[model samples]
Target: MNCRPRIRASLLASCLVLTVSSACGGGEAPHSAAVGGSPAAVVVAISDADRAAAKQTFETVCFTCHGVSGKGDGPGSAGLDPKPRDLSDKTWQASIGDEHLRNVITMGGAAVGKSPAMPPQPQLKGNPKQLEALIQHVRGLAR
Candidate 1:
């Protein structure tokens, strides 16, 4: 009896589970609206725990392209056509706001007239609060 069929079936099941989980808000928070049905203003509150988690996530995922210090000299930067953003530079960050950064992280830089090398993080979904924390952490690096 071949185990290949069973293994393939298991993999397919896992993928389906992940897809459903993502759609149902397993990790990300659901969007909310105001009383008038208008889009509510998002107020981002960055906690210490959220900042720490964001920092860890950045080190694991973003450090490969953005560098540990965000100097755009990561190991993957050598092969990239357009290098990653340098977080250490306040001048570059001056033009972009926190909302822009969050959008880039969630939707990729190409979505906002930036480099395509920056891909969207679908696997690493986070709520608006978590995103705000991550943005705050990145802003700190610019200083």
Candidate 2:
């Protein structure tokens, strides 16, 4: 038996799976272009009120599953299969970037082949501004 042919076939299958997944909206949401005409120039400006509101929202809805410190150690997390993500990890957050975070929160991680324990926050219930603030707050925790 030629192992090389088998390995190539397996690799091709894996790549096909990943490609199909991404094409079917199983990847990060596309980033919005900034007013300045540069995708990289887009910046979310959060106010103190927005931050406070986001903190409250996170405390009320998120803390139950993500923990008070965003460490994925919430009381409800005990029964979860995949468990919540540790928000305090700067490395992970940094690697994913703001766009990915927004997508995860808006569309959910499960939509992107991540842990399905994370549910999407409907835009109607979660204001974009508040969400942006929460993202900033999570980013601050990465240190």
Candidate 3:
């Protein structure tokens, strides 16, 4: 089935979120854009609330495949051909960039040429605070 319309809708929704966020007058630093119109990294501050939510999300969803200890050996991972990644693997963590992790989290593993079983989190795509919080949590998992 064709997916262009859905892709367009998602893009439009993302643009709308950026526009609304920019107009809110909060102290948030500019995201994905910088002075003189240059492309830049998003700089959202992850709050305590964000961390709580991230933890909940990780426990409820991520831990199903990635174990509670981030060891990639959750009960659900039994007999899987390509097993879940060990989140605490320092070598693997060091090999990937944050943007790659972000894409895999929000767009699914298949988007990054990994297993299709890893689902996409479209809900988190527009929530940088939570996204950053989750990313930080993953980073902290490194052993």
Query: Highest lDDT: which candidate?
Result: 3
The full ranking of all candidates by lDDT, starting with the best, is 3, 1, 2
Query: What tens digits encode model 3's per-residue C-alpha lDDT throughout 1-143?
Result: 11112334244434445454552135443333332332224445456899999988888899999987799998888877699999999999998877777789998998889999888998988787788789888888899
- lDDT head-to-head 1 vs 3, winner: 3
Model 2 per-residue lDDT tens digits across residues 85-139:
8898878876776667767777787877888778888771235567778777777
lDDT of prediction 1: 0.65
User: Residues 13-107, candidate 1, lDDT per residue (tens digit)?
Assistant: 33444444442134444333232332322343346788899898788888999888888888899998877888889898887765567668888
Candidate 3: segments with Cα more than 4 A from true spot: 1-40
Q: How high is the CA lDDT of each candidate model?
A: 0.65, 0.65, 0.73
List candidate 1 stretches off by more than 4 Å.
1-41, 123-126
- Any residue pairs clashing in model 1, and if so which? none
- Model 3: residue 42 alpha-carbon error in angstroms: 1.6
Give me the candidate number with maximum TM-score.
Answer: 3
